[model samples]
Target: MNTMKKLAAISLVTAALAAPADLTASARPARATGLPAAAKGCVPAMIDNFMTGAYRSPDLTTGSVTNTESGAMLGGRRTTRFQVAGNPFGFPSTAVVAPGDKSLLAVSSGYKGPTALAVFYGLRSEAHPEVLRADLSCFKRFEVNFVANDLPLNINVEVKSASSPTVYQCGVNTEAGQTNGFRLEFPFDCFVTNDPAHPPVDWTRIDRVLLLIQSASAMAANDYAINFFRLAS
Candidate 1:
């Protein structure tokens, strides 16, 4: 979808949130962005443009029979059940095949619901029991390029590891959403892991990654559209 349509999605989602529980494409709340330039020593583990089939449901990858709010597939996507949710404000969400008639992933924080879906990707490591893993030791940072409804906002991200109880988490700010769209980048240390040992990030043992959003805060806003993503070096 073009930037205009993407921005308009915010209105659609807002209207949807203001209305009934069930939302339609014509008006719904939900969306997810882009990256910046490469930094030195950045090694990409796995990046998907949604153009090619890279991620799928955990079931398809692990051959397990558990039902999660799955939408991480090569050709499929998911729209959040809630158009408006969260604490102070409602946030509708979506994880669908973006570009609507094409083959790409679309994530949204259009609403502020506490519940959001996960698009699982990256490496899988038995070393980390449940989460996925990757060796990011070679790199120092990661970045992604996505469309932004607003640049001054922050988006949520989580990196899971097998070595500790808490996952690496952080809030990244959006870039210029009008001209170049949004690009966000951050170093490994920026992510806060509850383990005081903060045991060395088993870069090689990274378990899994997820794209997340709160949907809304104290106010309402537009949604974002992602175009490309990568872990920079």
Candidate 2:
């Protein structure tokens, strides 16, 4: 079906799923802070499941070296150590700022699995934050980014109770010279889900969103990384 039709179908499904009760309460969008007034960009939000590792060089002068061409004797061996850094997911944090009316919500999930991760937004201490039952009429667009290394990745974002998925193909690119730094952006209609069966019709009521990253066949260290998140006004 066409994109419009697909969106409509997902909306209908979401309405049905949310018919039981209103979970999110209507509230005014939060104002921006610590950012330039004209700087229409993203900022950091809460991060989860981040991994920590270090790069190290090997040393070869601790032991005596031996060499034998025909007898197969080899040189000395050396060991290197790696220190683990604390993962940021466990920290008590908040998005530097919240989205404005007509704002954009951006999130990153460390590689986990194929299930779309759920992201919830609400007052700092509200109960049932995941249920976005608020009137989010001001939001117009949703931009998502999945940051990682040189590996092919795909993501599908879904609003809970909706019936479709927002499919995002995270194109792979060459790793830049900078270590521990990379990002990708995928822009989508805030209301439409890439999958007709899972449209984000309830975005208007969304206080939180969930993202699911499809798993790959092979796994590698630093295989997944989610640097930051932002909500554009």
TM-score of each: 0.53, 0.35
Q: What digit string (tens of lDDT, one per residue) describes model 1 on residues 124-187? A: 2111123233446666666666654542344545565545544566555443344446567666
Candidate 1 local lDDT, residue 81: 17
Instruction: State model 1's lDDT.
Output: 0.40
Off by over 4 Å in 2: 1-130, 144-147, 161-183, 186-202, 217-222
lDDT for position 51 in model 2:
17
Q: Which segments of model 1 are wrong by more than 4 Å?
A: 1-45, 53-94, 99-104, 107-117, 122-131, 151-153, 175-179
lDDT agreement with native, every candidate: 0.40, 0.28
lDDT (tens digit, per residue) of candidate 2 on 20-134: 1233333334323323322222222222211111111221212111111111000011111111112233221111111233222222223321211122232222222223333
